[model samples]
Target: MALTATGMGSGLDITNIVKVLVDAEKTPKEAMFNKTEDSIKAKVSAMGTLKSALSTFQDAVKKLQTGDALNQRKISVSSDSFLSATADKTAQAGSYGIKVEQLAVNHKIAGTNVTDPTLPVGEGSLAFDINGESFSVDIAATDSLAAIAKKVNEASDNVGVTATVITSDAGSRLVFSSNKTGEDNQINLTATDTSGTGLTDMFGTGNTTTLQDAKNAVLYIDNQKVTSQTNEVKNAITGVTLNLTDADVAKTTTVKIEQDNDAVKTNVQAFVDAYNSLVTAIDKMSSYDKDKKTAAALQGDSMIRSIESQLRSVASGRITAADGSSIALYDIGIKTDRYGKMSIDDTKLTKALSEEMPNIEALFSTPGQGLANRFYDLADSYVKSRGLIADRETSYTNQQNRLDDQREAFSLKMDQLTARLTKQFNAMDLVVGQLNQQSSGLVDRLNSLPGAVKKS
Candidate 1:
């Protein structure tokens, strides 16, 4: 009456039975898939950590791969009040007595002042020549002193010249200035007028005052004279550039250049530190924990082994130059312990840097076989695009995708099984219900028979 046959089916708890059967099939497979996923994800994370360490180590290696960074120089100036100096790698390490004999200035010229700055000069043009470069400003018959200055200042083809009007109590004057310095850059200008030479009367270069002269900077290094077009003098010393600020034949400043040892040591230590950090990362990834009864994700992995082997091989490398200059990290006091960590002997390192810097440079920065060079290449192979670590991550991700696909397929199978079991139980329940109905009717009819009650 309550449709229990379709649902409970003679109180057999069919719903729970079907659920238990489905769970029994799903739980183990689900747990296995989850375990596999966890393992793959852990491996991917470990690869990430290793990649990070490798990247940092590569940065330090890049700093040492070039001889420029390692062969840097520091300068000492006795006095910067008068001058300053800069040097490059080719500059020899020594002291030089510098004397600032002269300083250079830009050329400037000004025409005679006019009583009325608003009066037009004439219909004409003015041509200017600085060094070999030439430009011209057309003067209109109605253009005044201020107007002429503006035109010259705004000329599209004007070469490095500035025109300004300075008004004093006596009168207003127009001035022309340019960066026409050095003896080669002579400054000259001329005016042509179509009406009664009025343009030449107001702004003639022949009568203009030489406000400033074009002169070269002169300096002396160790009693040797040097000259330059501008204040910045070059090649007075090989690989050195001197900046002259003020002239004083009597004031002498001393410039000294030497190897930047502290900076070099700092860089070397950075490389060592980065290498040790990467080693630590590798160790963690490959370690097995006895207490936890667990192993690291990358434990016993071939890629890890290959990377460690490469590091050891690179660490033990050596190079020898043509001038009997031979070096290894060992000669620079970098020692390897049993655990493959590097340590420095301070005294030995100091001595090596002081005496064998050239050999050290050759060891770490000499193009193909240097320590930094080889290490950088190795690191690139592991961490670059589609490289070792990236390939592993990609593979792990693909595995995850496949596992998800398998899970989806399993889910569909379980759904089908659940539906089939439900259908079969419902059919069997319908048949049992029909048989019970017939039996009850037969027993009732027997009980109602004429002698059946008397027997009861």
Candidate 2:
């Protein structure tokens, strides 16, 4: 006979007993590996958060490290319509009387009018002289007025020349304009007709009218004369760029360049904000709640502790001031409280900026001893490739990989144990069924020999 189902002949739940035994052997080991994997993943995630916070702080530090941050200038013009201006750090703080006499213009010319745009002009080559560069386009007899204009625009060697068609009461005419400004950058056109197809007659040398003349911009600054080929004038005053928009001989606009104290204050505030955010992030990661019996992911981590310590030191360190007195962040109104939180005193900060602006800037950005430089260097070491954060993440990843291998091995072992247990229990059930059969045969033989009446 075929083997009975598991536990059927023995009247015992052999399958369930095997399951209980297998679970007892496998559950605790799997739980341990899973817990390790979770801990490693949390560490990797915490490292990512730390790197991001450090990068934000680094950006703010870089802004303070530049020379422009201290020497920034603001420009104001009396009339934007007359002229607009911008000044850089090199510009001196002063006022200048600016009078724009004339704005630079480009040369424009229109061809003689014709009845229709499609009408053929002639069959010849149209030569152009633009800014001393010479190029030409061949004209066919079948080429219309518009067609000739298209050919002129499509010329490969044409420099500073644009062609268009204009229709007025005088009829259809081709127009040409110079892309450059100033009198020296004029557009001159001449046509040659070999087949005498009237192409030269339509757009020849005499068939054009000067619509606008090219001229340079002329201006006066504090009684000093200035001329520019274009409206945009650079270096008219050192580190100042002037844009002359309109001409007004009788009106004058005053241009002023001055130190931008407000901008500097704003930059300082941004730095403070970024610094505070990073501090808060670090604090949260390293905090502990005694009452709740809970700790943060990076609590007690040596690397994180070291990073926080270095950052705080840089913030509070003293640097040699211009007047030989040591200065630090507190002198500039950036102060930390007992709990390591930062707060800015606006009144004190503004006063310090107004009185000792240079000293304040120098205190935070003075070469190797500068706060920003030290902070940036520290952050870079942690965030850059092969840095502290990267190495920590690598360690966690390796741990996770090992845990994965252990889990795979445990699963394989559990599977083999289950198969072996099932086979052993099935063999025990078969033997028990054979013993029951033998016992039943012996009982029937004893009943038959005792001459006992058949009790029904």
Candidate 3:
């Protein structure tokens, strides 16, 4: 009935020590569960890499969707042929008369020692008038034309001008032009210092020429002067895609670039893939087996449930169409089945996309109003929601601390008990020694008494 007993053969059992040690092993399992919970929690903890400002990209595409609303428009093509673009929509069906013009770059005066226009010449520079703005830059005699070119490039702030040098069979001549639009955007160049030892009179003619004769070309759209430039003009506002076939005076030609359907399709696919990746992750984590009674750690998380609902809601949302036909993502061929997987009916979607585009746009692209827009917003919000994962992680931390304390206490108790048990066993050893001494004395006395009796 002792509260405790200790020794090598004491009646008390050491099974509690064994049982507790076994229980301690459960920590690893708990740790794994905690880690999984943290992972699930982390799904909401950090903001996802965003879909690259979907609105901005969508707006850019939307602009393409509308052909410029001008009867006649002119656009200048870039000298660098590497860049190319197409309209998002074709011009309204019409007998569109198109023309392309090519201009030979005028290299009137080449600065001496300025082999490449990019290299600069000392105390030598070109002057030009752009939109009534007067500008003069003094190029040092030794400065390579390249150095002078850098200064011109940086003068975007002062002269409202930019300069480019076009190479021709004749040689390189400084080509300075107005960066602005309208009739005022003309360049008048005069050699400021063509007299230095470094300066050479390359312009056999005086410092003057028609701006059109220079690389700049004047373009008229539908008999309207849309642009007059010392170089090609980019009339982005008009949306006119100009292909310059020749820059000579009265040049006649046609330039055409069609709508870029492939780009739009690629963008759509990217969005679908991103969204599906998120869905797939959620589906795997939320899977459950009723018979087995097993559920994933994130199965009942509110955030997960909310995310699923928002996605479905967006996919099912409706919008009005141009032809008064009602439209929805489903109508446009985005299908979501019971298993929470999404697949697009490409044929149906594409037909709706190209033919009834306004309807498709209405379905998912209202700035802050459409279903797709709202759904993305919801996803953004839900991904930030707080919940159980964080709570459990905290609990695990607290439990680990408590376990450490409990183990320490138990170790101290075991040590004390061991010491007491050893002391008790050592005392018993002294008692056994005393008993041996007494027994030996008794044996000797009995042996002596027997011998005396025999002699009698």
TM-score top scorer: 1
Backbone clash total, candidate 1: 0
Number of clashes in every candidate structure?
Answer: 0, 3, 27
Computed on alpha carbons, the lDDT of every model, listed in order, comes to 0.86, 0.85, 0.51
List the candidate 2 regions with Cα displacement exceeding 4 Å. 1-3, 58-65, 132-135, 154-157, 197-206, 309-331, 335-342, 345-348, 355-395, 451-456
TM-score of each: 0.86, 0.84, 0.56
Query: What tens digits encode model 1's per-residue C-alpha lDDT throughout 1-456?
Result: 434555543556777888999999999999998999999999999999999989999998998887766666888899987788888777889999999888877788888888888887788998888878989988888988889889988889988778888899969888888765676665688988877787787667566888888788888899998888888888789888888888998999999999887877887888889999999999999999999989999999999999999999999988875476668899999999999999988788889878877787888898899999999999999999979889888899999999999999999999999999988887777777767778899999988888765543
lDDT of 2 by residue, 1-456 (tens): 545788876888988989999999998987888777777777788889999999989988888775468657899998898999999877988999999999999999887888878878778888889777989999888888778888888888888788899999889888889988988888888878899748566667677799999999999999788989899999999999998899997788999998798898888888888988998998888789899998888889998889878877887899997679888888878899876667888888888877777787787778888787888899999999989888888888888888888888989999999999989999998888778888899988878886667779
What lDDT score goes with residue 168 in model 1?
91
Cα lDDT tens digits, model 3, 1-456, are 122333223333344544455446545655765665565444333213122222333333343222222111222233323222233233332223333343324422233323466554447656656556776666776665566666767765457655556566766655555555334444555565655634335422353334443444455544455443434444432344443434433543334444344454555555556567767766666667889997755677675676678667666767664566677767767777786666778888777656765555555565665655565556444333353334544554676666666666766665666555556554554455456667888977876884455434
Lowest lDDT 10-residue stretch of candidate 2:
197-206
Give stretches of model 1 more than 4 Å off: 1-6, 111-159, 162-176, 179-181, 185-204, 322-324, 454-456
The TM-score, computed over Cα atoms with residue i paired to residue i, of candidate 1 is 0.86
Clash total of candidate 3:
27
